[model samples]
Target chain A: MATTIIETGGLTRSYGDICALKPLDLQVPEGEWLSVMGHSGSGKSTLMNLVGGLDRPSAGSLMVGGEDLLALSEDGLARFRREFVGIIFQQHHLVPYLTAVENVMLAQYFHSVPDEAEARSALERVGLGHRLKNRPGELSGGEQQRVCIARAIINSPKLLLGDEPTGNLDHKSTVMIMELLKELRAEERFTVVMVTHNQEVAAWGDRTIYLDDGVLVREERTNS
Target chain B: MLFRILKNSFLKRPKAVLLIFLSITMGAAVATAFLGISGEISHKMALELRSYGANILLEPSAVEGGFLREEDLPKIKTVFWKYNITGFTPYLFSIAEFSAGGKKERGVVSGTWFAKQLEVPGEDSSIQGIKGIAPWWEVQGRWPEDAAEAIIGAALAKRLNVVAGGDVTTIVRGRSQQFRIVGVVTTGGYEEEQLFAPLVTVQSLLQLPGKVSRVLVSALTVPMDDFGKKDPATMSKDEYEKWYCTAYVTSVAKNVEEVMAGSRAKPIWQIASAEGALLKKLNSVMLLLTVLALGASATAVSTSLMASMAERSPEIALMKAVGADRFQISAIFVGETLLISMAGGVVGYLLGDQLAEVISRTVFSSTIVSPLWLFPTAIISALSVAIAGSVVPLRRALLIEPVRVLKG
Candidate 1:
C-alpha cells in the first residue's frame, strides 16, 4: 500500500495575465520517480517551484506529506522546504565562496545542527570524498553537480526536486548523474519529481507527464 | 557553518568589507577625537580661567598715597561672605633701580604674600598668597621666604642680568637694600617686568609700614545675572543684603570692599565672562561636528554594504533555497558587520588618542589626559554606525525572492 507523498488539486500559478500553470490535478506516490516534460515557457519549472514550496500558487490546494503548503507562511514554507524537501537546480547553485564540504554542511545547518561527519559522508557517498575542500569554481561541471546532489540530500529529505538538474552537463556526465540519482533514490527511498525536456532523461523515471501551453497534455507510465 | 560562510565571504570580498571597516573606523575616530578634545579643552580652559582668576581687584580709593592697612586683611576672612573668598594677596608696588652683576634696570618692585598662613580669631587659619591665586605663573626656582629674598620677573632678570641665587641691590628714595634672588618668574604679562619681594621688605624699603597699594583676590563665584549687576549703594536695605549674600563676582567684590577700609573693589569682567562664552561655543561646535561625522560614516557604510548586497544576491538566494530563514540570513550579515565595527572601534580609539594629543599640542599648546570613558564611547559609536548602516541592506537581503534570483 503506497501512500501519496504529494497531492495537488487544481493547483494554478499565474504571473499577471499570463498563466504559467493552469489548474491541474496531480498526485505523486511515495518512492516514485515522476518526470515532467515541457518545452520552454511551459509550466514545468513553475510546477516544480510550487511543489518545492519556493512559489505560491495563484489558486488551489497543495499538500505535501499531509501538510497543506498553501496554508504555510513564508517562514513556515522555508522550514518545510528544509525539513521535507531537497532541490537540485539546473545551474548547480552552490555558494561560490564556500567549499564543497561547507556547502553540504549548509543544508544540515539550516535543517538542524550541522554535523560535519554526516556532510562529509554524504559527499563521499556522491563520489566527492577527495574534493571536499574544493570550491565550486575549482571543480568540473560534473563534480559541481555532484556536490549539489550531496548538499540536496545532506538532510535526508523525504522528497527530492530537480529542475533540469543535468541540463548543463555532457551526455556522459548527464548519464552518470542520473544513475547516481537512481541509486540514491533506491537507497534513501525518497520520491523524486524532475522537470526536463529530454526524452532519454524522462525514460529514467517511473512515469512522465507532458505540459504544453500551461496545461497537462499527456501522461505515460514507463518501466516499473 | 554560518560563521564559516561569512568568513569565506568576507575573505573573498575584501574590498567590500574593507570599505565598511574604513568608514566605521573613520567615523569612530572623528567622534573620539572631537569628544576627547572637547572634554580636554574644557578642562584646560577651566584651568586657564582659574589661573587668570582674579575676579576681585581691590585698590585704595583715595587719590593720595593712602593705602589699605595690613591690619584690615584679617577682617576679610571674618566678612559675611568669608568662605566664598578662596584666597587674597596684597601688593605694594614701588619703582626702584635694580642692580646686579654691574647691570642696572629701573623696574617696578612688587611686595606680595608668598604662601603666607594667616589666622583670624575664632575662625580656621588659612593660607593667603600669590601661590593660591596665580597658579599659571611659571617660576624657575622657588618663592621668596626671607625678608632679604626676592623673585625677579623673567624680563627684569634678563635686563639686570640676575639669575636665581644671585644678589641684587634695590634703591628706592635713596634708601637701598641688597636681596638674594631666589627665583625668576615668567608670567607672560606686564608682571614679567617687575621684581617680587616679601611684603615686609617692600614696606621697609618704601618706608610705608602696615600699608598695601592693592590686593588681588581669587574667589569661587557664580556667573553674574541682572540682580548681581545692580549697584549695591543704590539698592534698598533688603536688596543690598541679597546682593551681598550671593557668590556672584560682583557681590563677592562688594563683600571684600566692605571689609577693607578705603578700598574700591572691582570684578575682573574680561576673564569671568570670556570663560563662560568661550566654553559654551566650543562645546556646541564639538557636538555638532561629532554628529555630522557619525552621519557621514553611516551613509558611507550603507552605500558600501548596499553594493555588496547587490553583488551577493545569488548567494543569498541560494541560501534561502537551501532553507535559511530570515533570522539565519540576517544573523550572517549583521554578525559580520558587528565584528568589523568592533575591530574598527579599538583601532579608532588608538588613532583618535594620538590625534587628540596632536590637536591639543598644536592648538592649546598643552598636553591632555585621555579620559578612560572614551574607549567605550568609541566602541558604542562604532556599533551604532554598523547597526544603523545595516538596516536597509538586511531588509534587502530578506526581501530577496529565491525563485527570481535563482532562475538563471
Candidate 2:
C-alpha cells in the first residue's frame, strides 16, 4: 500500500537528431530500490539524471514526490535536488583540493549551512573516520568512494541515485559498497535508483529494469 | 562557507589566482600612478611656464611718451584677484651716457625693483620684483641693494669695459649720477644692452620721480577655453560677469588694469596661449594612457579567468551536481575574485605611489605627495576590472550541465 513517490507519463529526452530516451510510463513506490541495467548509450543514465533533476525532459510529465518537475525553474530544480535527492557518480567526483570531511561538508554547504561535526560523523559512519583529513588523491579507490557516499547522505535526501557508483572498485570493495547502501537504506528509508552493467550488482535491488536502445524492454522483481 | 571555498580555491590554484591578481594589480597601479601625477604636472608645468616671463604686460595708454605712475604700482597687489598676482615689477627707462673703466658708451639705463618689498595698507607686506617673476635671470655677482649701486647688462658691460665691483657714471641731458656696478646680468635679450640701476636713483637722474614706463605682472590663471576667449564687449551682462570672475589671463590682466589708472593691460599671448595649449595636451595624453592601461588589464584578467574556468569546469559541474544553485556558484567565484582584487589594490597602491614619485622626479624635477583619495580609487578600479573580467566566465560556468560534465 506504499504511495508512488515517482511517476512519469510519456517522459522523453533528445539531443538534436539523437533520441536519448523515448516516451515511457513508469511509477516507483516509496522506499523501493530500483536497479536499471543497460549497455552503453542505452539512456539508463539519462533516466537517472531526469529523476534527480540534473537534466530536463524534452516532453511529457515527470512528477517526483507530488511535485511536477517540468513546471519548476532551473534554480527550483537545483533546490529540489539539494532537498530531495542525492547522487553518487561513477568517477567519485570529490573536489580534489578538499579533504574527505571537507567534501562531505560541501554538500551540507550547498543544501544549507555546513557543520564540521556532522560532516565528521558522516565520514566516521562510512568507515573513513581516520582518513577524514586525507584528500581524494591520497585516498584509495574504496576510501574515496566511501567519502563520496558520506557526501551523498549528509543532506538526508528523500531519493538517492547512483550511476555506476562502484564501477571502478574491485569485487570486494563493490560488495562492501552494496552492503553499506542496503544498510543505510533500511535505516534511512529513502528510495534508491542505481544504474549498473553487472548482473550481480543488479541482483541487490528490489526490482530490476532492463533498457535497450532507449526503450524499456523488461522488468524483474526480487522477492527480498 | 563562501570564505572557506575561496580560501581553499586560492590555495589550490596558486598559479591561476596569481595570474589574475597580477593583471588587476598592474591595471590599478597604472591608473593610480597616472591619476596621482596628473594634477601635479599641471601645477608644475604652470610654474615652469611662469619662469619664462610675466603673462600680463601693463603699459601707458598714451602712444606718445606717457608714463605709468610708479606710486600706483603697489596697488597692483591690492586688486580683486590680488592673491592670483604672484609678482609684479615696474621699469623706468631713459637714454644715458655711461663711462666705466675709462671707456664711454651710449646705452639705456633701466630702473626696476630687483627684490623690493612693498607695504600696502590693510594687506600683508610682500616682496614684489624681478627676483620673483624672472627666476631664470642669471646674474654674475649680485642684485643692486643700494641707491648708488647698479647692475650692468653683459652686452653693455662689455662695451663699457666694466666688471663687477666697478663704477659707472651716467650723464643724462644736464644731470649726472654715479653708480657702483655690483653685478653683470646676461638675459639674452634687449635688457643685455642696458644698465639696470635702483629705481629711485635713475628717477632722480631723469628728474621724473615716481614715473614708470611699464609694469610686468605674473599671475596664476586657468586655461582659456572658447568661452573665456570671447570678448567681454560682446558678452551679455551675466556672461561678462562670469568671464570677469574667472581667473583667465585676460581677466587677470583686466583686474590689474583696473587698479593701475591710464594703463593698458594685455595678456602676453606668446606665454599664456602656449602654456594653456601645453597643459591641455598633457592632460589629454594622461587620460588616454589611463584608459589604455585599464583596458589592457581588463583583457588580461579576462583571458586568465577564461583559461582557469576551462580547467575548473569539472569542479563547477560537480558543485552543480551537488545542488549548488547559480547564486551559490556565483557567490563563490565573485567572492574569490573580490578578495584577490582587494589585495591587489593595496599592493598596487604602494607600487603606484612609488611610480608617481619616480615620474615626478624624472619629468618635473620635483617630488609629489599622492592624494588620499587615490587609495580608494585604486581599490574601486581593481574591483571594477575583476567584475568586468569575470562576467563571461561566470556565464559559462552557470550554463554548465552536470549530466554531460559528470558523465564518464
Candidate 3:
C-alpha cells in the first residue's frame, strides 16, 4: 500500500448555531480516487474545503503528506496549497483575460519560476495543445474545462481535487473530462478527492463516501 | 518574475498606474521646489545682510564724564580675541557742497583711512580703497590718493554732473577747496549720494583733526536665536554673560560698542528674521505637499489594486485551493507591487526633477536643481504606497474561500 497522504481525525466546523462538519474521521491512501457524494447542504464540500486548506476546521487533527495541517500557519498552508495540491472547479476558473496557455503558465508561475515548455506539455496532455492561445471566453465549455485540467496538473501537485468538475459539462464533455482525469491520475499517481452529486460521476472513484447533514452516512469501495 | 507580473499588470492597466505615478511625482516635485526656494531665500537674505559691509560698528564713546581716545583703535587689534577680528576701515565725514559746471550738489565729503590715501598696498590700487570702504559698493573708477582728489558716489555725481578726473569745487565749513573726482561708488542706497575724498584732504579741508564720528568693523557672526535676541537688562546673570560671550550678532554689536568711542551699534536682525520666517513657512508647505502627494498616490494605488483584485479573485481562490500558504500567496502579489513601485520611483524621480525645475522657473522665476537624495525618497514613498494601499485588497483576496468559490 502507498503512504497515507490524507488523514483527518475528529474534524469539525461550525457556522454560528449551525455545524457544517461534525467529528469526521477519514484516511486517504496515496494515489487513491475518493469521491464524496451528497445532496446540497451535506458536509462533502466542507470536508473538501478543510482537506484543501481553503477553510480551517473548528476542531481536528488533519495531516496532508505527513504535515500537520492544523499546526501550519496561514502562509505555511498556502505553500502547501501551491506546491502540493491541484484543484479543478465545476465553473472552470480560468482567468478570462489570459490565453489558455497563459492561464496554465500562471499555475507554474505561482508555484515556481514559470516554464513555458512545461506548461505547453501539460496542455498537450489534456488535449488542449491546439487551443493554447485561445482565451477562456473564446473556447467551448469542454475546451475551457480541459484548459483548467491542464492548469491544475501543470504544477504536478501531490493531490488533485475536483469539485463538481463535470457539473456544467454536456454528456460528451463529461465523458471526455472523466476519461482525461483517469488517465492523468494513472500516469501521475496523485491522490484524488472529488465531491459530486452525480452518482455516475462518483462511480469513477475507487471509493465513495456519502454524507448528509454534516455526517458521513455510508462508505463503499469498488474494484475497476 | 514578480517584476514581469508587475510590468504586464501595469501594461494591462496603464491608466491606473499612471494616476498613482503622477500623484507621487507631484508630491516629490513640490517637495523639491519648496525646499529649493527656501534655500535660495536664505542665501539671498545672507547676501543682503552682507551689504551692511560689516557685521560690527564702533564710534566715539562719551561716558557721562569720559571720552574714549582715538588711540583705543590699536587696543581693538590687540583684544583678547583679536584673531577673530579680520579687518576694519575707519571713515571721517564732513558736510560739503560740490560745484561742477555751476551745478552745486550738497553731499557729505567722506574720506577713508587707506594706506595710500584711498589706495591699499599689495591690492590693485585700481580696485582697493573707498571701493574697499563698502566692499559691497560697486565702483567704476580708481580711488584718488593725490591732494584735492576724491571719489564721488554715482548718485551725487549724477546730481552734480561730475565724472572722474573732473574738477569740482568743495566748500566745507566756510572753507573753499577744489578737488578732482577720480571714482564713482554705488552702494545701492544713500551711500550712492555721498562724496568720497582722501582722509587727510577731508581733515585739512574741515580743520578737524584726530576725530572720526564712527568706525564700521565687518566681522563674521552666527545667526541669533531666541536667547541671543533677549535684552540683556531683562536677562538673568548667567544668560546675560552667555549672550555677551557668544559670537552672535548682539554680542558682536556690544563688543564693537565697548571698543569704540561715542557711538551705538545694531545688528542686521531684520534681514535675519525675514530669511528665517520665509524658510520656516517654505519648509512647512513642502512637508504638507509631500503628505498630500503621498496620500493621493496611495489612494490611486489602492483603487487600481482593488479593481485588479476583483478581476483576479478566481486566480487567488485557485491558489488557495491548491494549498498555497498565505506567505506564498502574498509574495506573488506583494513582490509584483514592490517591483512596479521601484520602477515607478525611478521614473518618478526623473520626471519629478524636470517638474521641479519647471515649477521653480515659472512660479518663482528661479532655477531649481533637485538634490540626489530624492531618488531614494521617491522609491521608498512609492513602496510605502504599495504596502499601504494593498492591505485592504490583499485581505479581500485572502478571504476568497476556495471551497465556496469552487462550489460554483
Give DockQ for candidates 1 onward, in order.
0.59, 0.67, 0.40
Clashing pairs in 1: none
Worst ten-residue run, lDDT, model 3 chain A?
A: A94-103
Model 2 pairs whose backbones collide: none
* Candidates ranked, most accurate by TM-score first: 2, 1, 3
* Candidate 1 lDDT tens digits, B1-408: 877977898899999999999999999999999999997777666556666757788999976366989889999898877876778899998899989999898999898899999989999999999999988889999998899999989999998888999999999999998999999999889999999999999999999999999999877665566887787778999998787777777887878888888999988888767665666677888999999999999999999999999999998898899898999889899999999999989988888888999999998998888889999999999999999999999999999999999984
RMSD of each: 8.8, 4.5, 8.0
Give a tens-digit lDDT track for model 2, residues B121-231: 999999988889998879999998999998988999999889999999999997889999899999888888898988888888898898899999998888899999999
Write out fnat for all predictions, comma-separated. 0.80, 0.77, 0.68
- For each candidate in turn, the TM-score is 0.73, 0.84, 0.70
lDDT of 3 by residue, B286-385 (tens): 6777777777777777887888788677777776765555776788788767766776667766676677677667765778656666667767776777
Candidate 3 lDDT by residue in tens digits, A119-217 = 889989988889887888899999999988888888888899888999999889999999999999999989999999999988999999999999999
Better of 1 and 3 by DockQ: 1
Taking the tens digit of each residue's C-alpha lDDT, what string does model 2 give over A1-224?
99999999999999998999999788999999999999999989999999999999999899998889999999999999989998999999999988899999999999999999999999988899899989999999989988998899999989999999999999999999999999899988999999999889999999999988899999999765
Interface RMSD (Å) of candidate 3: 2.5
Chain A TM-score, each candidate: 0.99, 0.98, 0.98
User: Predicted candidate 3: what Cα RMSD to the true structure?
Assistant: 8.0
